[model samples]
Target: MTRRDDIIAAAIRLAEQSSTGQANLSVRAVAKEAGIGASTLRHYFPTQSDLHEAIARRYMHVAINDFSIDDSARDPAERLFECCAQLLPSHEHRQIQLDTWLSAHVNGLGPERRAPVRRLLEHSHEVTYDHLDRWLQVLVDEGHLDAAEVAPSSTALFTMLDGLALHSIITPERITVDAARDQLRWLIAKVLEPKS
Candidate 1:
């Protein structure tokens, strides 16, 4: 891997292992984890915002794009639901993600502390939306979804997934994985229904 890739990977590792998760991806911690001087790390990232953005982008890419679920034999609705499920926190990481979200958004931060956190959340949403958009278009190309349904369906699915994810994190007893899966599968089926 390139030095830049190494630095970003280190940042991701530190974030994952941290109490605050992604919100803890500071320049000094990442540099120390990478065993590089802070100056060298800064040379590649230039600023903390750049480093956080790179880390979030790479981490989300790996999390969503590299998910290993085998959907080849599944119907299109099932396949799409599997893809969307990757966005929700897995059992192992659910608590960590919840902690990070609470720390970054629920707990009050001064203006100086809030901007970077806000940027990271916004960038994460953008990356997630782009991936969802591409996944929906793939189904459309395969005759599973109408072209007109892509925009609204994508938005609705994203919003539902967000709420479902939060519920899974904050109240798993109420929104178990099976329940979430059923809701998502139902939504996907509705979106893919043929127009009369």
Candidate 2:
């Protein structure tokens, strides 16, 4: 990878490792992690805010790429449910990203800092909405749902998934992944099941 890519990757790793309760992030630390001199790191990222923005962008890109939509499934409902399930963060890295986002909000890095994060957040929402939209279109086309039902159904599913993700991140003990999955399954069944 190019030096810029290496530096961005290192900054993301550092951000993941260094939570809110940790020491301040430093160019020297990121440079060492990136296997480059601080001067070289500065060449690409002139300020800590620049590096932080790069990290946030990279995190968002990774999250977007993780959304695996399986269109080959015979059942449209199953495919839609699987796609929504993929939006939830894994337990291994969810807290790290959450911590990084929360840190960015309070760090007072100004527009330079907040802009990329805001873009990332918006991109994530758009990606999720796009997936839900497609699912609704498929259901409507298959005659399982009416065209008029698409928008409200898609919004409900998206909101349910977002709420589950938030609850999983904030109250893992109270709402386990299994519970979230079960809730999602029930919602999916309610929304997509035929009017038998």
Off by over 4 Å in 2: 1-3, 10-25, 32-36, 64-68, 71-74, 89-120, 130-154, 165-175, 194-196
lDDT of 2: 0.71
For all candidates in order, the CA lDDT equals: 0.77, 0.71
- Candidate 2 residue-wise lDDT, 68-153, digit = tens: 33344467667666777766655666676545545544443445565655665666667667667777777677677778778888
Across 1-196, the per-residue lDDT of candidate 1 in tens digits comes to 9999999888888877777523467788889999999999989989887897788768766777723223435577777877887766667777676566556654235445666667767777788888778888887887777888888998999999878877877788988767887888888888888889
TM-score of 1: 0.75
Q: Model 2 reaches what TM-score against the true structure?
A: 0.58
Clash pairs (backbone) in predicted model 2: none
Residue runs of model 1 more than 4 Å from their true location after superposition: 1-3, 13-36, 46-50, 66-73, 107-113, 169-172
